[model samples]
Target: MNRRLFLAAFPAVLAAGCGFKLRRFEDIPFASLYIDAPHGGAVAQRIRSALTSSKQTRLAASAGEAEAVLVLGPEARSKVILSLSGAGRVTEYRLGLQLTYRISDKDGRTLAAAEVIELSRDITYDDTQVLAKAAEEQLLYRDMEDSAARRIMRRLQSIGPGPAS
Candidate 1:
């Protein structure tokens, strides 16, 4: 029994000795940030929720009050048929979500250039389950939106303080 316990503890001890640490959210460089996106937009809401949870930066009420402004451009969603059944009915669909964004200082100096993040997922569909498939489609889009928000957060984390012009 003691031997088994020693064996089980060895890996943990080794990891600790090697300074291994779990990956976690990093701190944002800006003290306060303003997200310029539609208030009711799903992706924007997700990003706001993530920023709030991080506690690294405060959300500014307006662009003028922020140290940096995050401008979110138009978001686009698309669904295209990737495959079809013998009867010409839809068999599979490729769903895509694209968002454009940039980061700038209150003085309008670009901290990060404009970039686009695009995500896509494929789902098999059945005509017999129209309602169920529709629900699943919505779920997939929600997942994609959440993913985009996380990606944006990661990008934000990578940005360092730029010279104020």
Candidate 2:
């Protein structure tokens, strides 16, 4: 029993000695931030929900009221046929989501340069399961949006406050 216990705990002890730690959410620097994106957009909505849950930065109702403004460029989504069946039917498709964003202070000084985050997922398709495949495509797009939101949050955490004007 003692040997079995030691063996079970050995990995944990080794990890602790090596300082292995799980990643935790880092706080955003701004007290409040305004997101400039189209209303009811998927990525924007995900970002807003995340920030609200984090409670690190308040979401400003307007750009004028925030310490910093995050401007999101138009979101573009695409679906391309990556592979086709021998009969020329669609066998697989690659779905993509692209979004560009920049951060600036209330004074309009750029804090972070405009950057694009693009994500794609390849999905197999079968004509017999049209409804299921369509549902899968939507789920993939939603997953991509969630990932983009996390990336945006990380980018925001990396931005330090700009010099006082």
Candidate 3:
């Protein structure tokens, strides 16, 4: 019994000894930020939530007071039919999200060039399970938003202590 317990704990001990740590929000460059985006936008909300969750960041009241400002421009969502059944019923769909983002300093100096991030997923659909499929699609979009938020955080984290302007 003791041998079995030791065997189960051995791998964990080795992993800990190897200095493995869960990913965390690194010390991002700017301490405060302002987000410029349309109201009720899903992507913007996700990004805002992510930035606020980090203990090192503060949401500025305006662009003038911020060390870094994130400008979120046009965003789009599209569902494209990827496959159809024999009766011409949709069997698969590709849900896509396109978001354009850029970051600048309080002095209006561009810190990061404008870039577009596109995320898409192929989902199998069944006409018989419309309700379940709809729920699945919503979940997928939320997952994509979370992923995009994480990607944006990485971009910010990549900027070390640098000149604000």
Clashes of 2: 0
Per-residue alpha-carbon lDDT of model 2 for 1-165, expressed as tens digits? 999999999999999999898764578999999999987778888878878888988999999899899999888999999999889999999999999999999888899989999999999999999999999999999999988888988988998877765
What are the runs in model 2 whose C-alpha is more than 4 Å off? Answer: 1-24
Q: Against the true structure, what is every candidate's RMSD?
A: 2.7, 2.4, 2.0
lDDT, candidate 3, 72-160, per-residue tens: 87668889999999999999999988888888888888888888999999999998999999999999888887777777778888865
**Candidate no. 3 TM-score:** 0.88
TM-score of each: 0.83, 0.84, 0.88
lDDT of 1 at 110: 93
Off by over 4 Å in 3: 160-165
Candidate 1, number of clashes: 0
Q: Count backbone clashes in candidate 3.
A: 0
Q: Which model is ahead, 1 or 2, in terms of lDDT?
A: 2
Ranking by lDDT: 2, 1, 3
